[model samples]
Target: SLSDRLQGTFDKLRGKGRLTEDDINSAMREIRMALLEADVNYRVVKTFVSACKEKCMTSEVLDSLTPAQNVVMIVLDQLTKLLGSTESKLVLAQNRTPNVIMLVGLQGSGKTTAAAKLAYLLKGQGHSPLLAACDTHRPAAADQLQTLGNEISVPVFRGDGKDAVAVARDSIQEAVDHLNDIVIVDTAGRLQVDEEMMQEAVDIKSAVKPDQILMVVDAMTGQDIVNVVREFAERVDFDGVIMSKLDGDARGGGALSVREVTGKPIKFVSMGEKPDSLEVFHPDRMAKRILGMGDVYGIIEQAQKVADEKQVEDAERMLLEGFTMDDYLGQLQQIRKMGGLQKMIGMLPGGERMLQQAGNQADESQLTKVESIIRSMTKEERKKPKKINGQRRKRIAAGSGHTVQDVNQVLKQWDQMNKMMGKMRQMTQVSPKGKKKG
Candidate 1:
């Protein structure tokens, strides 16, 4: 919503050839209101808007041929700076055999999930990571961590009835015994900030002497995050932040406020519920997304991670000879692997507007239905869709547990996709004169 609001303001400015001081001030008013409504800390919003206003009023910006573009760039720069100009990586100790990363935050902040996601991320990076269940106060907290660890195939070290501090200290020993290179301790949190929670976090920190203490703040916490983080910073002196639930329907004020208010860089953000949904935070990429410029590089990085030999080969073939149902299924699977079409679309320029226009079209359930329909088809029918006549459609629909109309919809979509691919194939074809055909 902040992205949409800011983009709308900028679109108005971009439509103008020349902007007076009044226009700049008007846009600033809109931006200030947008930030406030987004739940950004009031002081931070004021400072940010003031800085942008000063920069935009400079002669260099006001007298520029593309004044509106310059103004947008200024805002981007300021936003990036506000978001901690650079990416802060989760640094592990190279000399230490088992680098300990302790997660601290309020209860319901998704600390347990963040622990598993961090372990999953580190394990994927070729490190042996062991999870430590240190949240002794909450019922089933250790069980939740263990369940997540099992899902990620990482080992979990529980202290049973031991205190949080003892569990943390022992988890390091467990890592050493098993030759685990890292240990992530999921520390206990309270329903709200209190001396008890802070004391427990300090005790755990002192016991394990973690290389990094990541404060896991819920992204939807809004301005309340400032006070929570301040208390945590004063007590545990955390190294960085792990923002969870960033993909929620919140205004994202907490995300914007944390770095500026606490002076701690955000090391990672949990975009979705999946274990692999944890992504290293990049301020510039985030700034681009907020401005509706999108994160093209992020999309490419995600694609490269999931793209495989077969996927690439299928793509090449699709361009040359159109795609079959099997190919479509493969592509859909690939999209799912890359966090679904909604995520991919969100990282595209103007994606926010496009999503607003195409409500529910980016829904993942639709993709699932299409997958089921394609799978219900015979192998021959998948390869040669033309073989699916009325009778076959009825059978395929019955098999997939859908009406024949759903099958016909899938076939119609396939036809549309093939027509587009045909156009692409023709365009990519080389002529005898050594030029590509149009």
Candidate 2:
């Protein structure tokens, strides 16, 4: 969406060898509009566009990028810096037995959900995380967290009382008792920021003396989120911010403004509702995505998280030899581990454009259908798909609850990938000394 609009602006200046005043003016106007339309805060959009314009005007366009691409690069650079240049990790003290992190935000900002997500992430990193339900005000806040904790297989700590402060204080002992290296305290939230809410947050902070107190802000709120962040920062003095519901189709302009205006790095972003949907916020990757330059590195990181080294080596070997239907299923599984097709597409540069071309086939359900079709096949047919004659194809389609055309589609995709992988393997061949053998 942002990519298409910006590309339209850049297309008119295609013939220009260098960025002239007129070209820069036209480009900046388009960029300004694009950012604003993307729901970026007005102040942030103004500052970002101004910086990109100034840089493009003063500096020579790099020979590597086209005049249009050069200006895009300038914008990308500024946007990256506008969002934080690097990842802000949730640091824990090595000396401490249990690292406490308190999550605070207004109601519906996803504070409770974010807590479980954080625990899921920490648990993945080999830390024993205990979820502390310090949210006594909400009717089912504790239950909601407990459900999430159950889903993630993490322990929940809830003291038998209405006092959130005491519950948080006692969670430390709970953490130590459970041998949890990390304790995530999910605090109560109100419809809006009020004195009572602030006081409760302050009391939790005072009682727990958390290692990090993160303010959770809803990214869809745009500029209004800044006010919430400011209030929480002033009242409770949060250590960092965790913007939630980023997966939703919000302009995400609020995210662009949060760090610059507040002077706090966004440590994490809640991408989806699942416990595993939380992702460590990487500014450069996000900026690249905004510019339609896919995040290859981020995709690789996610892939690595789900795939073992042995599996990677085996996949490469299989690709070089001849990937089978079973191998095809394995590849799909790996992609699924990396957050499915739609998410993967977002990380690729020009991915959204490609998505437009692919049409409805890019949906995650397609992958599921493909997996079902593969599973319906016999082991012999999977190893040698050519054995799957018309009757077998029909059987697979019927078993997978799809038409024969869908099964045919799956087979066609596998064939394409097999051929492509063969080509890649051939092109990558080298001599013993790592030089081209031919």
Where is the poorest 10-residue window by lDDT in model 1? 429-438
Model 2 reaches what TM-score against the true structure? 0.78
- Predicted model with the maximum lDDT: 1
Clash pairs (backbone) in predicted model 2: 40-253, 293-349, 294-347, 294-348, 294-349, 295-347
Q: What's model 2's lDDT at 310?
A: 71
| Candidate 1 residue-wise lDDT, 1-438, digit = tens | 888899889889988978899999999999999999989999999999999999999888888898988888899999999999999898988899899999999999989999999999998989999999999887788889888999999999997646888888888888999999999999889888999889988888888899999999998887788999999999889999998997876635788888998899999999888998999998988887777666645754665677865554455566467789988787678788876688776665555555566574967788889999999999999999977999999999999999999999889867756765564343232222332111
Off by over 4 Å in 2: 10-17, 62-65, 307-333, 336-339, 353-365, 368-438
What's the distance in Å from true for residue 359, model 1?
3.5
Local distance difference test, each candidate: 0.84, 0.79
lDDT of 2 by residue, 1-103 (tens): 6656765675666557666777789889998998788767688888888888887776466343466667766777888898888888888888887998999
